[model samples]
Target: MQKPHSINLSFLAFIGVLYSFQSILGAITFQGMPAVFRQSGIPPIQIGFIYLLMLPWIFKFIWAAPLETWRQKKGRRTNWLFLVVNSVAIVMLLLLTLTTPDVGLYFIFILLAIIAILSATVDTALDGFAIKESNALDKNWVNVMQIGGGYLGSIVGGSLFLLLVGRYNWKFAVYAMVVLLLMMLCYVLFQQQSVKELGQKSAKQSLQKTFASKQVQYGIFIVVIAQLGLRLAQGMTMPFFIDYGITLTQLGVIGSIGGATASLIAVFLTGLWVTKKGPGFVLISLLAVQISMYFAFYYFSEKAELTLLQASFLLLSNSACVAASFVALYNLLMRLTSPEQAGVDFSLLQGVDTAIALIAGVISGALVQYLGYQSYFLLCALASFSALVALPLLNKSSSPLKVVI
Candidate 1:
């Protein structure tokens, strides 16, 4: 038996920075690319198909087990993988700067899919690294770091990048991202591996053990349903705003400043509530609030013309609800993980969540085309409500499995 290393801020902060850089990569594909396409008159259905490039995330679990074995033999390779993939990602960005969607749409998507593969690999490694380093108490803070860092990254990658695109041109925006990527690469190269590395073993037995449990099955359903509506609605938001006459710069300011600020506040408050009342309670409450916010957005969109201030407020509210929802659900997932099998269990859970979200995202464009925005939003509200039906599954008598680090 061995004592686990205590949690350290430097390690936690490193994870946060990694998450931020990853979000920047994601923003290039999801945020920056979509905004460009929409402005170029690409249809919503076509824009929806762009999400298909993200399919690698849904399938990363296929490699996660083997990667676990490799990790054991290699020792901590977070920096190695991070540096390699980001190096390739930077090359892709440079090539992307030369081609426009109008000129090379399919080629751009092909490159994006490749980038997604590398990014997903980095994501899998990072999640394992975070879980292996943190104990039960620190896991919540880890979740905060994950979400808060993503918000910060979204501000930089999503909003700020959009501003650069608006202010100058797409090439300039891509050039800007390349510079940021280089800075991150330098940081990753210089940073020492600060946490103790866990020995890798085949996750097959852990997989069998996890799937055999009724509680684990129930937890899987909870994560899928909990995340479904948010993913679906989020897929449609940029198009929704564009159709509503919102300018890209306005969206950038709202998202970078207002959304990021609000989400950080929400994460902090949710952290407090989770400490006081527990994750199960916080999860259900956040889901209820999420559902309400969807309806609220629907009402506002239909009933009146929204001024910039009103729109900003609505976007902030949306960001806050999303932040709270992520914190709550991840908190729940962290509790379900067994320390010995953290990699496989978390990957399987996340992979399934991404799979469900992929289905929802692919269909969301058609759903909106068929139903219109108001009805589409109501549909999201209804989908979120379905999660409440699964609440009984989480009500098992004993406490959640404690993580022994």
Candidate 2:
């Protein structure tokens, strides 16, 4: 393992800002739009198909190696790619503003798909940059930026966007997003430091070698088991809220105020816990909390009536657990990535994570429709429990391959 590097607060802050841009788009496409569609009377099954828009993220590893090579050959930093991709994404968002659900729903979906592809590309570049810049000791804070900034973006894209749409109009909401993206782009362009290059050795790294590592294989298995149930349960949350008579503004308020606050706190604390106790311990502990939350959600779903306060409590608590678990999981994956092929290795792990979550999300709505919310939540709990049972295997697998950190 490499000796721990000195922490650079400016670089971490830049990473947080960069990740916020990607997550803002994600929150809008995945969370905000789904609630809007559900409110517009779209069926849950049809709403489920929205997960497919995120397919680029699931398979981005296919192109990650080539992109990394291209960057190395050109001697261009990841920040350059980040700027270019986000610029295209901004244009795509502008195009989306021309279309509405009433007349151009399919067009809007198509544009969002293009934007997802751009955002996934940005994620690939950003992950590689973060891995290269930070050493093992400070990597937890890197993930804090990734997950914490993500929650912050969710407040803007998921919560604030909905609030704007409810109070003003769709175009106004979208224009707000456009302005934010432009500001992020400007910030990146003005930054003085270029990412340190990976040089000849990294340029020689291949995806084949990355996949063959035992650590990579074990990481894949752990991610799939840990994330699938959580994503499945989360996929239905907004829809369930809509069906349960929660208004759009109320959902926005919950996410903006309660959800963001709880998630940020959880992310920060988990960063500290993972630093002190290690990711494996933190993951198992948080997974237990997540399982309990799922069961609580199950109990709530069966109620004849749920008060706003009750719903807010459940959502906020679950948000915190989700944020913490993600921090731990990403910390583990970061340790699995070799710096030589950081882009390919990390992208592959994240790709697997996204693929499983995407599948679960795609089917979650139909399952909820078929089995009802109570049964669906119970099923999610069982899935999470199975992951908890399998956690020991992750430890066993780690013995064969020294962690790359």
Model number with the top lDDT: 2
lDDT of 2 by residue, 121-210 (tens): 989888877776675436778888888987788778987788787778889889999998899789878763543443343555588988
- How far off is residue 168 in model 1, in Å? 1.8
Alpha-carbon TM-score of each model against the true structure: 0.91, 0.94
RMSD of each: 3.0, 2.4
Query: Across residues 84-146, which tens digit of lDDT does each residue of candidate 1 receive?
Result: 877887888788876878778998998888888988888877777677666633667877888
- Poorly placed runs, candidate 1 (over 4 Å): 1-6, 193-210, 213-215, 303-305, 396-405
Off by over 4 Å in 2: 1-4, 192-201, 396-398, 401-405
The candidate that wins on TM-score is 2
User: Positional deviation of 21 in candidate 2, in angstroms?
Assistant: 0.5
Count steric clashes of candidate 2: 0
- The local lDDT score (0 to 100) that residue 126 gets in candidate 1 is 77
The candidate 1 region of ten consecutive residues with least summed lDDT is: 396-405
